[model samples]
Target chain A: MDFNFTPEEEAFRDEVRAFLDENLPENGTRDMEAVAEFQRRIREKRWVGFSWPKEIGGGGGSIMEQVILKEEMARRKAPALGACFMGLAWVAPALIEYGTEEQKQRFIPDILDGKYQWCTGYSEPGSGSDLASLQCRAVREGDEYIVNGQKIWTSIAMWSKWMILLVRTQTDVEAKHDGISCLLVEMESPGLTVRPIKNMAGGDMFAEVFFDDVRVPVENRLGEENQGWKVTVSALAHERSSISEVYGLTRSLERIKVLAKSCHRNGRPASEDPGFRSRFARADARIEAMRLNGMRFLTKQLRGEPLGSETSINKLHRAQLEIELGELALEIEGGLGVLVQGDSAVPDDGLWQRHALSWPEVVIGGGTPNIQKNIIAERVLGLPKD
Target chain B: MNFGFTEEQELLRAEVRKFLDQNCPLEEVRKLCETPEGFSRSLWERMAELGWVGLTISEEGGGVGLGWVDLVVVLEEVGRSLFPSPLLSTVLAAKAVDLNGTEAQKSRWLPGLADGSRIGAVAITGDEGRLDAAGIALEGRPDGDDFTLDGEKLLVMDAQNADILVVAFRTGSGEEDLSLAVVERSAKGLNIEPHRTMDLTRRMGRLHFDGVRVSADALLGSAGSAWAAIEHLQDCAAAAVCAEMVGAAEGALKLTTDFANQRVQFGQLIGRFQGVKHPLAEMFIDIESFKSLCYYAAWLLDECSPEAPLAVSRAKAYASESFARIGVDSVQLHGAVGYTWEYDIQLYLKRAKWARPAFGDAEHHYQRVAKLRGF
Candidate 1:
């Protein structure tokens, strides 16, 4: 297989590099005004959602070009393409795929413009890995759905202007995946309440959202009633670019390597310690494996093949690597590892300490390692289901 | 940037797989392993006719000029069948000659190797078993038009049958002074003793060189400058072994998966138990990941990328460990039958354990990676 980019692709990569060279702020420090200006410029260039369709104000770039754009941005350590995380990642894609014409016009532009954030409402207190068994209830009336349920682990719910809520519109179904429905509800709805939950790392990036008779207009329902599971599944499967995740881990590992050189163990730099060196090198090799695996996945997508359980492999690697690297960084720090952000003696403001404690977000959030293994077994390997 | 084989390469893979399935089935492998021949001459000749032995050699060298990526496909298939042959050792020797041999040397050796009229073996490690400068205790003392060679080399694969031995020896005191010399198996003062290795699919030999005089013309590259070529050869060998391990691991996983699907336990198929199924799943993941690494390493070497060395080391290190792990788990999932000599799974287990430290073990490659990463 050819690993070299085509000349045209190379030119596109050069163009991305040129754009970043001219516009990316020195040191990659972005204040509010600079961040706004940067987003505006990328949005103007249609690089923000570069893979989305041109008919929808996107760059309409090829998948390869999108990868180049992302690689260049990650190399320069530039700010994320848009301020909206879940919105840009999944919400807009779902909307474009299944939303009504009016709904797309209403939400797509704001989401692209980074005007506000959007959070998902898939995981309930009782329904996690078994997400299809969600019990959030929404009964439809004349032109509204009376939503009433609680959604735990609603990431960014406290700050998002809207929530892509998954509700149970019907219960009497043969399959658990059938009765679930997707609804777009405004955070400002009268009966909706968001109680922020502090994570183990002492951050409130997510919340437990309570829906008490929240009146969402029937028009806000995504796709057909009782067909929202299809909408959500298809949306999540929109474009599998877990390859982009590799750049982040690569950068993180680089930082840890630098720390290894500076941090001391047994009166010598930790990087010189045989044990630490082996760990660092092993982590490095594993990350490279993930990157190559991502390329394999990208190749499948490029060949017009729909990605399935293969993505879970990298998810598993990412989970394990994130935890391993975080712990290794703290171990390099020794006693100083226990210090937090505000502690005076903390190294790098105790970034490693928080990282060590914050692994559940990556390891346990999307799907646990066990779930990923099950998917690989039953789907990829064609083994009998347990 | 596609991480896949071309259509022609895929065809080559399918053809090799079919050939092995028909000609080198498990029974044949078992039979050959039992015989002193260790491998079938007819199968070797047929594979040579298929142009596999000299796959990466240039057309001028009397073989099809293909890249490492193409060779990787055939090697993977060979690995899948557990084909008892000297293809790997022969290819590695051919690679060394192709990389450094002069026109005269190429004309003298490559054609025989390319046509499979002659077998080749690479004697890298000595008694210490380290694949490095320290491993080559053999010393080749220059005397006029010849170099007198004297040392012992151990664990030389297919050495008993190899017509040509590519021997690494110390030409000077410095580590970088290590050189490689091509010596004939019929050399006057050389002895080749075959060892009954635990892995019967391939045979190992110990070579004793007692003042064996080799013409200076047989030096593959410049004297005292063979370390670089030797390292490159090691990388090539490691990557090739990784490809083989990937194939073997895939084979083991397939057998285990089928067994789990059919075998009944406690009134249910063993595959229905998460306890039995999850390990198989884990094996699948490891194989897939290792396969990706193998393909990437093969591509990097074919492209001659500067990162090829590190990539090869990564693939080798991972495969060396993961293949062994998959082998153990596959046998475990198969229960008692997997442990029997009559069963095929034990063969894979032995191959995995044998290959764990063949070119370089996991720890050695990890150390190499750490060095390459500037740690």
Candidate 2:
């Protein structure tokens, strides 16, 4: 019923604002040294792994506080807390949940310190939403497991120093999920190769990574020998938190407002156009709805309630919203929308074009809208499974 | 930072819902919708007896003195049952009095309106339904110590049953041009032509105010000030309407899902099909989103937050479209029989249609949001 943050939370918000005033990047730009320094400051503030357990080099922040930190950071458009997007977002949490003490000690600090990057290897050419049915083979030989697999859509594979990979160690189990195993593999391993794949945005942010009989030590095996499915499920859920999307959408909305004020059509600002304002307003409302829904989930999490399948609601919304925002931005640009970056006449330097093309990362990547819908339908609503 | 109903509010919701189930069920609603009057006097009196009419006004003003958020809980239940009454109009009119009426004016009208002894309605907008200050087209000319109103108020809800009409009209060529006047329904020059609409459960009428004259004391607040009252009522009403629409959407989805669970097609339950379930699932998402937006908007208004207007517009716009989609899909998912007159799906669909544009349609609110964002 109460929407006001507690005075302490308000004070914490003030603290975050002050920190941002001093340290947030100018125009959200980041250099290597700036990135390292930013990561160091946040890690010292214990915001890098804010919601993870303190025993594993985390801040062990209360869920609500973590939400506040995230909201404020996103509002300021601050760079991500650590350099390892996948590792800090999913891998570290997975390791804390399933990895041995040795694994935690060996990996948690570097991940939090921005010392190296980590990529994911769950989706194969044939494995996406049905990731548990992966056919990437890993045969146990003495103290090492010989792996052979090709993982596609592995974003950052070319730049990552390590990977949290999923493989089939025993294909004879009764269920597909039971036969899979998780492994921590080094990218510089003798038999591994990365071939960067240029996306529609004409960027090599994602790649096709091939593992040719790579030897991963037995100690690198995460969780049980054949229980990688559980780890992957948990990690993916973490990946779909929706908190980040709320912040991201808020920033996008602000940009859209600014563009509406500046962009002109028919000898007046597009913001003055009823049609243009209506679209931007609709987007604003949807984003606000998504943001409030995110807050509801945060409230639930604060109460120690497990956020079961409801997070899918935000994921589904985020999918549509990202596409809508990109289209709206381009629409605001009128004829210049078709022009790409480096074009003299283009607006926002083709940011909207790249954004429109980047829907795959959001809409189709973590779980397609269909997959999220199915989850909401069957799990959240308790309807008959389709 | 919690954005949910309190424990007492939860109990109040259950109680209201149970009362609606007993007194305002679908069968009763259907019976009323088919009738010319479109509402049962007995049920309306019973609701009033339950103090539902005074749920939001202050104690001295003969209300429960709760805020808009609490009122949303009641509205949602009313929407779920498709309750046939003049409750929303009465409540809004009563709120207008509380916000803009002088003390003497309040004392004269507040008790009657809150206790439901006398019903009230507000004609805030005229033709085209643009809900801003400039939309007040019911012209009022200064006549000595009185004002003579001329023109009609379109789509005035429950005008036939209303005992009082709080009319928003433009008075003269001055900064203080817009004003509100409280006129009795039995006034000599006023005419109420009962009308029909897509939503049969709710009565509508055109208020033809030909030379409707009232003393200057009839005016609520200062001259040229009804705009603030109009905006306040719009914000609160929009949030409540969202709640109502979300509830109706939830109800329709339930009807659709129940039918899907039993109805077999192609040798399988229709619920087993992705076609049937996916849209129902999407409706669920929209409903949840609408619920959040409604609550947030209500919260902002209750707190008198500066962002209240934008939040309310956002809720109204999203709820309008979401409820419409849910209403249409609810019928479509039910197959051939759902479109028939005997089926209840159209009840929700019709209400969705009317409620969407009542305060402001999706496009209207979107335009409002644009303006509010300083676009």
Poorest lDDT segment (10 consecutive residues) of candidate 2 chain A: A233-242
Q: Which docking band does candidate 1 fall into? A: medium
Question: Residues B47-164, candidate 1, lDDT per residue (tens digit)?
Answer: 8998888888889999898988898899899998999898999888888899989999989999999999999999866565687776677888889867899878889989999999
Tens digit of per-residue lDDT, candidate 2, span B272-346: 888887998899988988788889888889888999998888888999988988888888888789889899998
Each candidate's DockQ: 0.75, 0.72
Q: Which sections of candidate 2 miss by over 4 Å?
A: A28-30, A235-244, A261-263, B173-175
C-alpha lDDT score of every prediction, in listed order: 0.87, 0.84
After the best TM-score superposition of candidate 2, give how far the Cα of residue A76 lies from its true spot, in angstroms: 2.3
TM-score of each model, in listed order: 0.97, 0.95
User: Highest DockQ, which number?
Assistant: 1
Worst 10 residues of 1 chain B by lDDT: B125-134
List clashing residue pairs in candidate 2: none
